[model samples]
Target: MIVVERTFTVTATPGAVLGYLQDFANAQEWDPSARRTSRVGSGPIAPGAHWRHIRKMWGVTTELTYTLIAAEPDRLIFHGRSESATCTDLVVLHPVPGGTEVTYRMELELHGLAQLATPLLRGEFEKLATGGVTAVTAALDDLSRPAGLRRRLGAATPNRLPTPAEETGI
Candidate 1:
């Protein structure tokens, strides 16, 4: 078994932060470890909502299915399993002085051959999880910043802006 946890202080309110985080489709936007994520069921996120994700780790691609185990306005817990392993992930949001305190934790169990490689794999997994947290934190920060400031700072610039068509010369 391996576990990793990270906490970040984000400028957004807990409700706002959780709203974005709970959107399964947004995982790829904030979670650096996720190559892609898609909702598997219809409707909003709630208990029993399922998501499938492809994540890259150690230069290998892996797929997992995550089922929402618990969902509250301020907290969410999910369990994910692949054919080869199982893991639980918990995310908590707490109101803070300036913003919100977001904590993410993951616990994983390796089976079969994976178990044999656990000793070598644990450290890397921990590092990967930590990086994911950092990426989320940074993304939240960017999201919380004022739009004007974000534009001026050239951070997280959007992909397209309307441009006037060039006049044709006769």
Candidate 2:
């Protein structure tokens, strides 16, 4: 098993941050590893809502089905399962002086034959997860930046946004 977590402050209200984070599909907008994420079963945002993600890591792509296991005003928990692995993601939000403090924690465990390969794959898993979370941090930072200051961040990343075909394919 591998566990990684990060905490960051965003210049958005706790309500705003909660709303944004509640939608798992938003991962496509922020997480590099998530090639695509879409709601699989949805009526309202609550426990039991499901999302599907086509995630790419270490040059290979696989699908994971994630279900919200817990939801509250300030916290959320999701359980994701693929054929070879299961991951749990916990997100906690709190109001701060200026904005919101976001804490994200993820735990990944290998199962079946994949367990035997964990040693060989741990480095890549760590790298991929770190990069994805970093992307999420950068995205939230960009959104929170004052509009006038954002342009100074330089050119937009082209490939970061998937093309129409990629979106549909995933």
Scored by Cα lDDT, where does model 2 land? 0.77
- Report the C-alpha lDDT of model 2 over 40-73, residue by residue, as the tens digit: 7438878898887788877779888889899888
Candidate 1 residue spans exceeding 4 A from truth? 146-170
Q: Each candidate: what lDDT?
A: 0.76, 0.77
TM-score of 1: 0.80
What is the C-alpha lDDT profile of model 1 across 3-66, one tens digit per residue?
8888889888888788777765566765666776778757767789888777887787988888
* Candidate topping TM-score: 1
Model 1: lDDT to the true structure: 0.76
Instruction: Report the number of backbone clashes for model 2.
Output: 0
